[model samples]
Target: MKVILTETIESLGIIGSEVKVADGYARNYLLPQKKAVLASQANRNMLKQEKARFELQIAKEKAFAQEMAARLEGTSCTIAAKVSDETRLYGSVTERDILNALAEKGIEIEKHMLLLSEPIKNTGTYNIPVRVYADVEPEIIVEVVAE
Candidate 1:
C-alpha cells in the first residue's frame, strides 16, 4: 500500500515522504496510530506545492544567515567568567554563553547555529564556527577572561 508519512519512520523515510508499505502495516499499524495517511492524488499535489513553498522560504533564510555571517567574520566577543584561581574558571563557556555574549555585541545568533565540538573548558582565545548555511561559513573569535 502507498502511504504518506506524517513524521519520520525509523529506517524508512522522513516526513512528507511517500513510501510503500505492506497492506497490513498501513491499515493496521500506521493508520490506527495516525502515523501516516493513505497516499492519494489530492494529498500528493498538496504536498508538492507545500514543499515548493517551504524550499523557497529556506533559501531566503539561508541568504539572510549568510549576510549575517559575513558581518560576524573576524569579530571578537569577550565573556567574563568567575575564576577560582589565576588560571582556571569556575565554570565552562557553553554555546548558550556564546549566544548571549553575541547578543550583547548586537550580533544575535541562535544557539543551534554555533557548530561547536564542545564547550570551552579553559579561558583563552577560541575560534568558533557559526554556520550561516550549508554553503556559507563564518568564524568568530571568543575571548574568555576571568572576572
Candidate 2:
C-alpha cells in the first residue's frame, strides 16, 4: 500500500516521502504509530504544505544530535568487573552497564541510541559508536578493567 511517511524511517523513506509498503505493515504499525498516513490527494497536499515545517524540525534535531556528538567525542567510560584467572570477565558488560556509567558522568542517552553490537567479555579498551542521528555517529572509549 502506498503511504506518506511523517517521520524518517531508516528502512523506509524520509519525512513527507510517498512509498509503497506491505498492507499489514501500513495498517498495523505505521498508521497506528502515526508515522504515516494513507496516500491520497488531500494528504499529499497537506504534506506539501507542512513540508517546510518538517524540514525545520529535522534541521533542529540534526543540530542537537551534532552538538551531542561533539560532547561525546572526548567522553570515555570505565567499567570494572570481576575476572577469572585468564583475565576474562565472569559476567559480560552489557549496554545497561555502559549506560549507567555514562549516567554517573551526567550524560544521558536513550538505550537504542547506543550501538553496542554485543556484550564486552574481556578486559580491554574498546571504542563504541553512539548513533546520535541518521548521519551522525560518534565513538566513545570504553575501558573494561578487572576488579
Candidate 3:
C-alpha cells in the first residue's frame, strides 16, 4: 500500500516521504501507530507543502549539531577520582562519569554518543570521540587526575 510517512522509520523511509509497504503492515502497524497516512491525493498535496518546512527544520538541526561539534572540539573536560599509590583508578571512569563531567562543563551529551572502547584505568589525558551529529564526530580531550 502507498503511504506518506509522518516520521522516519528505521529501514523504511524518512519524514514526508512517500513509500509503499505491504497492505497488512501499513494497515496494522503504520496506520494504527499514526506513523503514516494513506497516500491519497489530498494527503500527498499536504505532504508536498509540508516537505519544504521539514527540510528546513532538518537543515537547522544539522547546523546546530555542527556548531555543537565545533564547540566540543575546543573543549576539555576533567574528572577527578581517588586512585591507588600506583596511580591506577580504584574505579574506572565510565560513560556516566563522562556524561556528568560534560554536564558540569555546561555541555549536555547522551551516553550513547560517546565512543569509549574501555573505561579509564589509569590517570592521564585521553581523547574521546563524540558524535554530536550523525555525520559530525568531534574529539574531546578528557584529563583524569587523582584526587
Candidate 4:
C-alpha cells in the first residue's frame, strides 16, 4: 500500500514522502500512530507543492544570511559591561550580549547561528564565526574593552 508520511520513518521515507509498505504494517502501525496516511491523489499533489515551498523558503533565507554575513565581515562591535579591577568581566559576555551589540550596529543575528568557542571573560579582542551558508562562514570582531 502507498502512504503519505507525516513524519520521518527510519526504514521508509521522510515527511511528506510517499512510499509503499505492507498493508498490515500501514494499518496496524504507521496509520494508527499517525505517522502516515493513505496517499490519495490530492495529498500527493499537496505534498509536492509543500516541498517546493520549503525549498524556496530555505533558498531565500540562505541568501539573506549571506548578505548579512558580508555586512558583518570587517566590522567590529563592542559590548559594555561591568568589570573588576583586573579587567575581568563580572559576568562574561554572552551570545545575547553579542546579538544585542550587533543589533546596535543594525546587524541582526540569531544566537544559535553565532559561533563562539567561549564567552568573553577578560578585556581583549576576539573573533566569532557567523554561519552564512553551509560553505560560507564569516567572522566578526568583538572588542571587549573595560567599562
Candidate 5:
C-alpha cells in the first residue's frame, strides 16, 4: 500500500514522501497512529499544493535573513564595565550585555544566535560573529571599555 508520510520515519522516508508499505502495517500502525494518509489521487494533489506554499514561505524567510545580514555588516556596539587596575573586567561581558547594547541602537537580536567562545574579560576590541541565518554570518565589532 502506498501512503504519504505526515512525518519522518527513519526506516521509511521523510515527511511528504510517498512510500509503499505492507498493507497490514499501513492499516495497523501508520493509519492508526495518524502518521500517514493513503496516497490517493486527491491526497497527492493536496500535498502538491501544500509543498508549493511551503517553498514560497521558505524563500521569503531566506530573503529576510539576507537583508538582516546586510544591515548587520560592519555594525559595532560598545559595552562599558567596571574593571580592575590591570584592565581585567570585574565580571565578564555576556550575550545579554551585547543584546542590550544592540537594542539601544534599535537592532534586535536573539541571544542564542551570538556565537561567543567565552565571555569578554579584558578591555579591548573584539569582533563577534552572529549567525543571522544558516548560510549568513555577519561580524560586528564590540569595544569593551572601562567604566
Candidate 6:
C-alpha cells in the first residue's frame, strides 16, 4: 500500500515521503498510530503545503539532539554493586541502574535511548552509547565498581 509518512521511521522513510508498505502494516499500525496517511492526490497536496513546517520542525529536533549529544560527550558514571567475587557482581547492572546513576549526575534520558545490548556483569569500565536522536549517539563511560 502507498502511504505518506508523517514521522521519521528508521525502517521506513522520513516525514512527508510517500512509500509503499505492506497492506496489513499500513492499515493496522501506521494509519491507527497517525504516523502515515493514504497517499491520494488531496493528501499529497496537503502534505506539500505542510512541507515547510515539517522541515522547520525536523531542523529544530536535529539541533536539540546535537545539543544533547554535546552535553553527553565525555560524561561518565560510576555504579557500585555487591560483588560475589573479585570480578563478578552479585547482580548485573541493568538499564535502570544506569538511569539512576545518570539521574544522580543530573543527566536525564529515557531507558530506550540507552543502547545497551546486555547488562554489565563485571566490575570494570564500559562505554555505553546513548541515542539522543537519529544517527546522533554519544558514548558515555560507565565504571562498575565493587561495593
Number of the predicted model whose TM-score against the real structure is largest: 2
Cα RMSD (Å) per model?
Answer: 6.3, 1.8, 4.2, 7.6, 7.6, 2.0
Ranking by TM-score: 2, 6, 3, 5, 1, 4
Which of candidates 2 and 4 reaches a greater lDDT?
Answer: 2
Q: For residues 1-147, what per-residue lDDT tens digits would candidate 1 score against the true structure?
A: 999886556445656689999999999999899888889999888778778664666567667867888898998999999888875888889999898888888887777778889878777899988876665679999999988
lDDT of 4 at 54: 50
Q: What digit string (tens of lDDT, one per residue) describes model 2 on residues 25-123?
A: 999999999999999999999998998998997888888989999999969999999999666999999999999999999999988988999999999
lDDT of 4 by residue, 16-92 (tens): 67899999999999999998989998887877878876566556766876887788887899877788966888889
lDDT (tens digit, per residue) of candidate 3 on 13-124: 5678899999999999999999999999999899878989878866887799898898899578899999996689999999899999989888998888899999999999
Flag the better candidate by TM-score, 3 or 4. 3
Tens-place lDDT digits, model 6, residues 1-51? 999999988678778889999999999999999999999999999998999
Give all candidates' CA lDDT scores: 0.82, 0.92, 0.87, 0.81, 0.88, 0.94
The TM-score that candidate 4 achieves is 0.59
Task: List residue ranges in candidate 5 displaced over 4 A.
Answer: 1-49
Worst 10 residues of 5 by lDDT: 52-61
Candidate 3 wrong stretches, greater than 4 Å = 1-5, 8-49
Q: Mark the 10 consecutive residues where model 6 has the least summed lDDT.
A: 8-17
- Candidate 2, poorest ten consecutive residues by summed lDDT: 8-17
Off by over 4 Å in 4: 1-61
TM-score of 5: 0.67
Give me the runs in candidate 2 sitting further than 4 Å from their true place: 9-13
Per-residue lDDT of 33-145 in model 5, one digit per residue for the tens? Answer: 99999999999998898886646655776799899999998899999999987689999999999999999999999988898989999999999999877667899999999
Where does candidate 3 have its weakest 10-residue lDDT segment? 7-16
